[model samples]
Target: MRTYVVGSGVTKVDRHYERNYLSLINEAVNKALADSGLDISDIEYLVVSSAFTDSILNQVDPSTYIAQNLGFRKTRALTVSSGEVSGAVALDYAHALIRSGKARKVLVVGFEKMSEYPSWIINRVYSKILEHEIEGIKNVSPPEYAAMIMQEYVRRYGVSREDIVKWSIKMHENAVKNPYAQLQFNISLDLLNRALRISEPITMLDSHPIGDGAAALLVTDESITKKMNGALIEVVDIESSVNLPIYLRDDITYFSSTAAAYKKISSKNEIRLDKTVAVNVYDTYDIYGLLIIEALEICGRGEALKCLDEMPYLNIGGGLKARGHPVGATPLYQVHELRELMSGSSWVKYDGEISLAHSMSGPDNNAWLILLRRWV
Candidate 1:
């Protein structure tokens, strides 16, 4: 499919959801329309993404409700729930529909209001995303599972606790400059050094906080992009991996789904991931980020450190740790952030090449990758 991102937008990611879930989505959708210089009527299709909103915020079928609120009563809209990967999945669906000639312009919006519930209740909601047999009955929190993976990753990669803390410090430092970031605290290495330790090596600083936010993207056909003089950013390739039960997996160090999806994208497209100008990887936790980096084969088995020194593009937009991971909105925010960097609106500069965004889930635990470029 020849899908190009015409425009994108995001509301400041924070817990200030004085508005309802649908209202948040409409605000973001309107922003995307304004950014693209298009009206709400211009969107032929719309996809909505959220995970805990319906359960915690009491807003089920947000797509229909949001579309009506945005004056998209006549347009087709569907809700997508895929844990944290819902945003990426929604993008994939829009791209496919456009490429298949089923739609012309699609509006994709992702949102979540996690602050609606208390922290402990929110933790319970996330735990439901895990397999019941392996994690549900055990009442293993998401951070607990992540901590288990962190233990394995540390053993395999020889990554020290200090290395992860350094990453957190850098992320928060970057977040201070991002006005939209929820955790704008400019933390130093020393603070992260002593930040409350949650699970052995995994500390409270290492995990993404429960924030509220919304993000939107306008994807159009290649022809429509030129006709509208759209700020073209090509969706070069999109791939998704199947869900895997954590306990059934062969190795925690290697995410089979991520590896498979990366391989598929590599074989089908001319994506030079290593040379990409910028990258946004799913980073709900430091360990998860490390796992994805390794699984994508961006570096050698135990060479994340070496890769880090070479690749500064990894999560420069502050990632989930710094940018505030608002669940469903995280990936969409990544796409928007990458678009800004590619369009030279960001502080960083590149040769006008490719940028990538990766998103994952915890329940089905699906993982997805979206590769983009300024020019094909």
Candidate 2:
């Protein structure tokens, strides 16, 4: 049976000083159940996105604890972790369960709590995702990885600082309308260039915020979805590709996994990039955003900036750049953005026909792309 996402929910991306990880999950799951009109007992599977465990916070075994606390004792529970794309991986498992006749309905929840720890602790955790031996031993962060990617892109295409800065401006502009976005405020070209640089070509404003948030979605197939009204989306296709690490790849500027996945997708389906209502590429940094546009070949490799005027819905929910990447929960947030954009829950009424949510991990070596056709 074809799967459909019938319900979705996302907590505001910000520092929840009072809420713990369990509280955040409860808030998002309850909202999703209420919206989908599904009782807690109706859910047969629970897939939780698990990323990091903070020693300072005394957290452990998130999936087991969360399922029990949410009163999902009898339901089969599993956890999926792929660095920052935990949510996407979890969604894939949930989709397979029903497609395999394991369960008719499943609930996928992704959440992360980063504010409880110090900056250095967060850095150590993020560094390990890329390459534990090198990055973790040397204490290298994710932004530093993006910096190397940006510098290489500049050398290859002669991309100027001005060209790269425009991408950040576009992301910020899109975030202003998304209330769930952590950094909704806009920034000008001057501010972007002058802003403190973390890794050359990327500034503080260019990266996604560090915040705590959770998102949940209800997954079922098209057959059962017909009984419900119109609030559902069809998962037309799901594809994934894995490439060698950045150090092993021929070109660090290009993401081979994205290319391979899209190449396979294009042969089977007609992907009208121009017709897509929302395209959520993993935008770890502004330069990462350009590489995303270029990798998909949505527009010309170096011409991503020129198409910004027309790609207003590029990151309807500000993407990871402004919407805040709670790491594990981010892909789920992208799914939420698609639902809101089609349901008229977005800041403005989106006249969109199709939306695609894509996420990459380990510096774009691995990718997961999900195509959604609007049923509203």
Candidate 3:
């Protein structure tokens, strides 16, 4: 009934403008199998996560195509897309399959090819996140949505420009160590303060770039882990939720869906922050990571800055910002970072470590959080 991540891998998040979807995934999937000490023969099911493939590569039912090409022709395959949350959702499916005893091992892959199209075209595709009334008609894009939320948060919470810059700087620093990260340039807080603003307080540096890459994870039951001697990161709890829209949420200060997920994770695991060692919350933008701290109940409202001062914060080295937010592959990257951050002589980990990952598609919609723990 319990599922554990046996192995995981991610391709270097970079501009693979020359490569197609299948090619990108081929590298990622092969790395995943090698990491898990398993082969294609051990895979019983495949879950592919991609959203831009239809327009970018003119491909549909990519899961089947990937399965066929990977020599898992007869294995069951499913494709899922939920904007930026596509990767996390695919992971959720893999966990479900393992929990239900329907599959012994599920290979979950999330890939996106955004650089294949022009910026305007990519913006048009991202516009699907909004309603037909506002965004669909006015062409409000993802960056604009993030800008609005960020403006409101700064105004309401009195979060200074320095707070946002710190997050970006940290993520970039972390990316330097993460060879798989797309952007590894480090900018000091002083340099960030001098940069031009994007929309109000939102600067160009506050956002994640359009990246192309793939990430994969091989999830299986605990019994399989024992037999394989693979690295074990137990999934103690996982939950998902959605809110009608940003306006409909109880508060815009933090995502309601994330709050809902936090409650579920706590209730299921009966654990609290005192026991948690770290968190890898979705950080598509600087403000989102700031909002996540409050939403996850790790700190009180407008207390993220204080929390950062005392406790380690999200996106240690340039989270999604520097790491590359390859839409469909962000969640898997988070898991990858979590596993490494908790193992060996890592920067942050304790005797009994518990790490949490939180992600969302748009606003508060299609949210999910996973609680993971290191065994001994």
| Candidate 3 lDDT tens digits, 195-302 | 666555667688777789898888888778877643468777778888777656566767878888888888888877631457777777788877788888878877
List, residue by residue over 1-376, the lDDT tens digit for candidate 2.
8788888888999988899988999999998998888888888888998577543356655778888788997888877777777888899888888788878889999988878877677766767677777656766677887888878877888867667877777777878888888888888877864788777666887777778999999998766687898656876777889988777888888877887887776667787566245788899888877777777778777667677777767887888888888888999999888877777777867766677788888678678887887876
Candidate 3 residue 278 Cα shift, in angstroms, is 1.6
TM-score of each: 0.94, 0.94, 0.92
User: So what's the TM-score on candidate 3?
Assistant: 0.92
Error of 2 at 334 (Å): 0.2
Per-candidate clashes come to 1, 0, 5
**Ranking of all candidate structures by their TM-score, best first:** 2, 1, 3
lDDT of each: 0.79, 0.80, 0.77
Q: What is the alpha-carbon lDDT for the whole of candidate 2?
A: 0.80
RMSD of 2: 1.9
- The better candidate by lDDT, 1 or 2, is 2
Stretches of candidate 2 off by over 4 Å are 54-58, 275-277
Worst 10 residues of 2 by lDDT: 52-61
lDDT of 3 at 108: 89
What TM-score does model 2 achieve against the real structure? 0.94
RMSD of each: 2.0, 1.9, 2.2
The better candidate by lDDT, 1 or 3, is 1
